[model samples]
Target: MSKTSTPGQIRRLTKAHKMSFAAVATIGAAALAATLVPAGTADAGTTVAAAPVAWTQAVEGVQAKTVQHLSMQSKLATDAAKLEAAVKAKAAAAAAKAKADAEAAAKAKKDREAKAAASRSTVRKPVYANNLDGWIKESLAIMKAHKIPGTYNGLYKNIMRESSGNPRAINNWDINAQNGVPSKGLLQVIKPTFLAYHVPGTPLDQYHPVANIVAAANYAADRYGSIDNVNSAY
Candidate 1:
C-alpha cells in the first residue's frame, strides 16, 4: 500500500540530510587544501620562520658562554702576570739587599784591616827625645835591646873624667890629634873609633852626647867586656 509522510517526520528527515551535507562539504574542503599544498609545506613557513629565532637564540647563548670564558681567561692571565712581576720584584729586592750587605761587609773588613795595620806600624816606632838625659835614657833603652851591659853611674863617671861632662870636648894636642884624627865628644872618641863602634838608633854626629856615649859604651863593651867594667875614663 502507498503511505503519505506526516509534516513532523518530513521536517526531521530534511534536517538530517542538511547536517550530512555540511559535514561532507567540510571534509571535501580539507582534502582539496591537502592536494593543493605539499605534504609538509603548510607548516614549513611557520617552522622556517621560527627556526631562525631558535638558531639565533642558541648562537647567542654559545657566544655569551664563549665570551665569558674568554673574559675569565684574560683575567687569569692578568693575575698570573701580576704574580710573576711581584715574584721578580721580590727577587730583585733580595738580590739588591744581598749585594749591599756583601759590600758593607767587605768595607767593614777593609776598615778593620786598615786600622790593624796602622796599629802595627805605630807599635814598631821608637820614642824620640832631644836632651842629654833624654838621649842617655834612649841610649840605655837601645843598649838594653842589644844586651850591652852598662849603668848610668858608670856612664856618668866615665863621661865626667873623659871630657868633664863636655859634649863637644876636643883633644887636639894628643897622639890621636898629631895623626890628624883628634879625639872628640864627651867620651873623646876619634872619628874612626866613633864610626867603628856607632850603635844603631844613635846620631851619626859624634858631638851629640847620646851618640858619643853610645859609641863609647859599644867600644868599651866589645874590647873590655862591658862599659860597667871600666870604673875610670874609658
Candidate 2:
C-alpha cells in the first residue's frame, strides 16, 4: 500500500528549510568581511598605525637635539680651561719681569759703590813727620848742599841755648826785641839778620829750620869767623 502527501503540509515543510539556509548565508558573509579588512582599520574609533618613514624621522630629530647639547657643553668647558691657563701664564710672566728689574737695580747700586770706593782711594795724600829731629836732619842736608860751614853738634848746642830746640820760639824779652828787632826760630835770629843773610837754596821764612840754621851760620862766619868759635848765644 503506497502513501500520498497533501499540498498544504508539503508547502509548510519547504518554508522552514528556506529560513534555515538564509541564516547560514548571513554568518558566512560576516566571516569574509573580517578576513579582508586590517585590524588597525577595523572600527571608526580605533587609532591608526604610524608609517615607517614618519617613525624614523622622529627618532633622528631626538638624536640630533641630544648631540647639539653635548657639543655646546664641551665647547664651554674648553673655553673655561683656556681662560684659566691664560691668566696663570700672565701672572708668571709679571713675576719674572719684576725679579729681573730687582736684579738690575741691585747690580747698578753695587757698581756705583765700587766706583765711589775707587775714587776715594785715588785722592788720598801721604803724611810726613813734624818733629825737631826731622826738621834738623832736613836742614842739615840743605846746609850741606849750600856749602854752609857748621857741624851738627855746634848747631844743636846753639839751638838748645837760644830756644831749647823749639822751632817756633820767640825772644820777646831779649835785648834785640827791646830794640824793635824780635829774634825768632830755633836759633833766635832777628828778622833783619835773617833777611840780610838769607841762603839762596833755603826758605825765606825766618821760622823755618833750614833757613834759620843756614842764615845764622853764614852770619856767624862773616862776623865771628866761624860757627865753631861761638860757645854761647850771640
Candidate 3:
C-alpha cells in the first residue's frame, strides 16, 4: 500500500521548489514553471516575461545637452565678429585724424615761411651816407658851367658807371700813355683840360668829382656827338 510522506519532508520539497522558481524568475522572466505529470498525462509548462525598457528620458537629456552646446558656440562666433569690426573701425578713424592733423601742420608751416619772405623784401633796403639830393644839386651846377648838352640824367648815369660816384678816382700812369694826364676825381679830368677850363671859383686842381664832371661834360659835348654816345665809348 502507498504510504503518505511525512509532513516535514513534504514541506521541505515545497520550500525547495519555491526557491528554485524564485531563482529562475530573477535570472530570466521568460522561463516558465514546470508542471508535475499525473499517471499517463503529458507535462505542461508556462513562462514569465521581463518588463519593457523606456528610452524617452535618456534621449531627451542628450538632445538638450547638444542644443545648449550649439547655442553657446553660435553666440561666441557672433561676439568675435563684432569685436573685430569695432577694432577695424577704430583704427580707420585714428588714421584719418592723423592725416588731417599732418595736412594742417604743413599748410601752416608754408604760410609762415611765405609771410617772412614778404616782410624781408618790403621793409629792408641799404641806406647811403651821402644824400641823393645833394649829389644831384652839385651835379647840375657842373653841367651848366660846362655847357654840356642833354639832361642831368646823362651825367648821373656816366658818373655811376665810371666810379660808382667815388670822388677819389685817379690814373697817374696816364702821364706815360698820354691817353689821359693826371686825370683825377670822379670824371677823371685831364690836367690840361682842368687848367684851361677851370671855373672862376674852382682851382686848377679842382679835379674834385663835381669839378671834373663839369669839365668832362663840356669836353664831351664839344668832341663826341652827345653824352649817351660818349658813354657808348664812341
Which candidate leads the pack in TM-score? 1
Instruction: Compose the digit string of candidate 1's lDDT tens values, residues 1-234.
Output: 889999999999999999999999999976665565556566643532223446779999999999999999999999999999999999999999999999999999999999999998885756757755666677777888878888887777787788887787999998899999999988889999999989887789979888888888889999898777887645
Q: How far off is residue 75 in model 1, in Å?
A: 4.2
Model 2 CA deviation exceeding 4 Å by range: 1-129
Clashes of 3: 2
* lDDT against true structure, model 3: 0.65
Error in Å for residue 7 of model 3: 99
Highest lDDT: give the candidate number: 1
What Cα-based lDDT does every candidate model obtain? 0.83, 0.82, 0.65
Q: Taking the tens digit of each residue's C-alpha lDDT, what string does model 3 give over 159-192?
A: 7776567777766664523664555666666677
For residues 1-234, write the lDDT of model 2, one tens digit per residue. Answer: 888889988998899888888988998866665665676676866544444556679989999999999999999999999999999999999999999999999999999999999998895533325676666666666667777677778778888888898889998887898999999998888999999999886789999887887888888878887676778878
Give candidate 2's whole-model lDDT: 0.82
**Candidate 3 deviant stretches above 4 angstroms:** 1-133, 145-147, 173-180, 232-234
